[model samples]
Target chain A: MVVDKMLYNLGRYVNLLRDAIARPEKFSMYYKETMRQMDAIGVGSVFIVLLISVFIGMVTAVQFVDQLGDSFVPSYYIGYIVRDITIIEMAPTITCLVLAGKVGSNLAAEIGGMRQKEHIDAMEIMGVNTAAYLIMPKIIAAVVVIPMLVAIAAFVSIVGGYVSTVLPGSLSHTEYVLGLRSFFVPRYVFMMFVKAAVFAYLITSVSCYMGYYAKGGSIELGEASTNAVVVSSVLILVFDFLIALLLT
Target chain B: MIRTENITKTFGDNDVLKGISTEFYAGKPNLIIGSSGAGKTVLLKLLIGLFKPTSGKVYYDDVDLFSVDDDALREVRMKLGMLFQGNALFDSMTVGENIRFPMDMFTNRTLGEKEKRVDECLEMVNMEGINDRFPSEVSGGMQKRVGIARAMVLEPKYLFCDEPNSGLDPKTAILIDELICDLTNRNNITTVINTHDMNSVMGIGDNIVLLKDGHLVWQGDKSQVLESEEAVLQDFIFASPFLRRLREDALKQRHAHD
Candidate 1:
């Protein structure tokens, strides 16, 4: 029974995306909406992503330094390990996991509120194609902007690694820089972007599906928002593992 | 006119609308009234093609709603407008922006033209100016009027208002009824209103359809309401003792004078 329900919902989610990905009824209207979403999703979320990324780098560097402190491992390996872990796993995965809470919850709440308020119904009556008008712009904006955020996260994490270690004299700046430049594969950067884009699409689309089908009253709407975050968080982790398996 | 041919809808084992057929004439206020859980909303949604009937047809003139393609259905919908019970105004937008949204989506009109149409719609509802205010900044009555303005701004051929006077003072409710009636008459639009407000029932209910237990129980103009012998109609319309007494007294006075 549970598996049947899950399959039914997955089918519905796929259908909703199919409808939402249609060519918009009007280009100008959709363009304006896309710009608005870009401002909301991109410009609005930078600070949180940066702040968290900095701390992620700091924690990884500090822990690795302590772990390797008693061993014969070189101190410069701390910078290399932090850089690799952040780029390969921490940056895209952790940042999007946080966004699944912040941006994901916000998307679900917004669309669900509109559903409860009858805004979606009103738009439907006007022949505005509510799914496309509401969901597509958001998806477009998130996919384009979230990768940029993940890139910023990766860069800042390296800087944070530097600040935490070199400032405290745990390692020299020259050694840390040298470690960062070591074993830098351009393919890893491509993998990071691929993960960021995939995660961005998952969070936005899943959250939107939750919101678009939300019915009943405020309690139901709140449940939709929570479900969006929870579902997106889980999907991000599952995809992260899959991407790792494929790329590595 | 819009016609329904034995429209029936069911949810699982529960029948909400049971093979009901009705006609809504144009250029007048056509009302659908019923007690709570009588399925007025379901019928209204069916009429608007929001819910497909299980085994029947709804025709906007000659076009069978269920038989048409997506583009054709969208064409039919483009000529439609609706005012929700809650107004459904976009909270983040100002009154003018909310009213102008449909035009922004569908028309190639310049900014000046859209603004002019917005002002004209507001004026039609007797709510001129205050376009800069958000929906939260307005009174409930003002919000209803704004909703009416937005619904009519596109000059749609069909207008559906779901409980247009749910939360308002009696006087304002009557005014809103008058405004909707006036708009209907002027535009020659098929205006269907689902409402429980008594003043709206008797004042502007030029064509009323009453449903009970998912069946069309009684239907007539306002003049026939008092004279209606259908117990279900009387029971539902005059459910309150005070209104029943007033109705009886008014009938008695009329008979005495005759």
Candidate 2:
């Protein structure tokens, strides 16, 4: 029964996306909505993304340094480990997981509220395609902005490692800088962007689907918001594993 | 004109609208009234093509609503407007922006032209100026009026209102009814309203259809409501004890005069 319900929902979600990508009624209107979403999703999320990313790098640096005690591995391996880990996993995955909670839940609640209030119906009656108008701009904005955020997260996390290590006198600044420059692969950067884009699409689309079909009242809206975050987080982790398996 | 041919709607195991046929004419306030569980809303949604009937068909004049392609259906919908039970005004926008939305989406009108049309619609609803205020800042009656203004801003050929006076004082409810009635007559648009307000029924109900458990049990104008012998109609319209006593007293006084 659970599998059947999941399949049904998956089918419906695909169909909704098909409808959501249709030609917009007016280019100007769609452009305006897209710009608004860019501001909300991109500009509004920078602070939280930066905060979480810095902490992720700090924790990784501190923990790895302690674990390296008496080991033959060079102390500067901490910088190399932090750089590679942030690029390969922490930057895209952790940043998006945070966004799934913040931006994803918010998208679900906003759209669910509109559905409950019949604003979507009002737009439909006006011959404006409601799904396309509401969902497409959000998707577009997220796709464009989330990768940039992940890039910033990657940079900030490396800086955080430097601050935690170099400023604490545990590791020499020259050694940490040497470790940062050592063995950097350009392909890993490519992998990071790919993961960022895929995760961004998953979070926004899943949240939007939850919201678009939300029924009943306030309780249902709350459920939709929670489901959006939960479902998107799970999908991100699952895809993270899959991408790691396929890419590495 | 809009007509439904034995339309039916079912949700899972529950059937909301049974096989029922009805017609709403243009240039009149066609009211649909029923108790809480009746199929009035389902039927209204079917007419607007929001819900596809499980069995039957809905026709906007000669065009079958469900039979048309998406593009064709959208073309038909462009001529339509609706006022929701909760007014459904965009909370983020000012009154002028909300009214200008449909125009902005569908027309190539200049900003000046759109502003002129917005003012005209607000004036038609007797809510001139105050264009910069948000919906939350307005009173309930004013919100309903602004909703009406937004719905009519597109100058649609058909207007559907779901409970236009659901939450309002009795005096304000009558005023809204009169305003809707006046607009319907002036525009000669096909206006269908779903309402449970008795004052609205007797005041502007040019044509009324009553539904009970998805069946069209009664149909008539306001004049026939007082004389209606249909038990369902009487039970619904005079549900309150005070109205029933009033009805009985009026009948007794009429017999005494005779």
Candidate 3:
């Protein structure tokens, strides 16, 4: 049933895409709206990313050094581990998860409230395509902003790893930077970029769908918002595993 | 300018509108009145093409609403305006922006031109300086005015208002009714209003269609309604306690004089 529903929605999206192409004005407005949405989702989330990333990097580094020690795995390997795991997988996945909580909820609430208040109906009556006016902009913004957020998360986690491993342990600071570059490969970095982009698409589309179908009143809207986050988080993980298997 | 012929709508087993037909004239306030659950709102939705009639046709001028393609239907809708029961103003936008939304969607007007038209519509609704306020920051009456301003922003030839005075106080309801009537006359737009409010029926009911149980029981001007001796009509008309008491007092006075 779920797969069928998803297929139906995909078909609907294709139709909307066609409609958007036909209406240049709606398309232009949708593009502008997407930029505005990116600011709200990506730029506004910086504070949390900074606070969480630094600590995550620091802690992951500590665990690596504490368990392996200077002789066994060498403390330098901590940087490599942080770079690979954090950038290629953890950062993108976790950032989107956080966004599912923040952005997903906000999207659901906003759309649901608008629906409850009949603002969407008003738009339809005015000949404004509500999908183009509302959903397309959010989709555009999410696609643009989610990747940047993943980059920020990657930066923070590396800094955290440094604080956790280098600052606390006997490992020299120079070794940490060297270890990060030692195992660095073009493919891994490419993988991280792909993962970030994929995660961004997953989170935004699911959230928008939740917000779009939210019915009843304001109370139901809140429920829909929470449901959006939960659903997006699960979908993100599922997509993450599938991508990982494919890449491997 | 708006006509529905044998329009019928049903939800599952429950029929909401049962073979209803009505014509709403341009340049006047056309009122649809009924008791709760009498399908007045459903009939209004059918007129506006929000819900496709199950077994009949709704004609906006001569175009059959249900027969059109989606693109054509959307184009037809562009010529329409609606004031929803709850005002339905975009809460994120200021009053001026809300009014300009239709113009933004349907026209290639410059931002300056849009702003000018928004200002003019707001001014016409007597909402002069409140352009910057959000819907949440406005009173019910103010929101209704803003709704009206937004509805007429595109100068649509057809307007549909579903219970414009639903949640307002009596005096506010009167004001909104008058405003709708005035706008209808000024623009020569075909306006259809659905209400259970007696005040609305009397105030701007240039042509009134009374619905009972998803069917059109009667339709006539306000004067014709007053003289209607139908028992169902009387039940609704003299149903008011105050009017009933006044009738009783007048009867007693006549008996004493006799």
Q: What DockQ results for candidate 3?
A: 0.60
lDDT tens readout by residue for model 3, A1-248: 99998789778756654554345345556666778888898888888877777777777777777777746676678788888888877788887888889888888788777777777777767666676677767766777787787888898899888776667654678988988888777776667778777777666666766776688876788888988899889988998898888886
lDDT of 3 at A133: 73
Better of 2 and 3 by lDDT: 2
Model 3 CA lDDT for position A193:
72
lDDT of each: 0.92, 0.93, 0.81
| Model 2 CA lDDT for position B120 | 96
Mind giving the per-residue lDDT tens digits that candidate 3 earns over B75-181?
88888989999888877789988898777767888999999999999898899988899989999999999999988888889989999998999999999999999
**Candidate 1 lDDT by residue in tens digits, A75-135:** 8888899999999989999999999999999999999999888899889888878889999
Real interface contacts reproduced by model 2, as a fraction: 0.85
Q: Write the per-residue lDDT of candidate 2 for residues B192-223, one digit (tens) a residue.
A: 99988888888988899999998999999998
Clashing pairs in 1: none
Cα deviation at A126, candidate 1, in Å, is 0.6
- lDDT score of residue A116 within candidate 2: 95
DockQ-based class of model 1: high
Off by over 4 Å in 1: B256-258
Real contacts retained, model 3: 0.72
Best model number under TM-score = 1
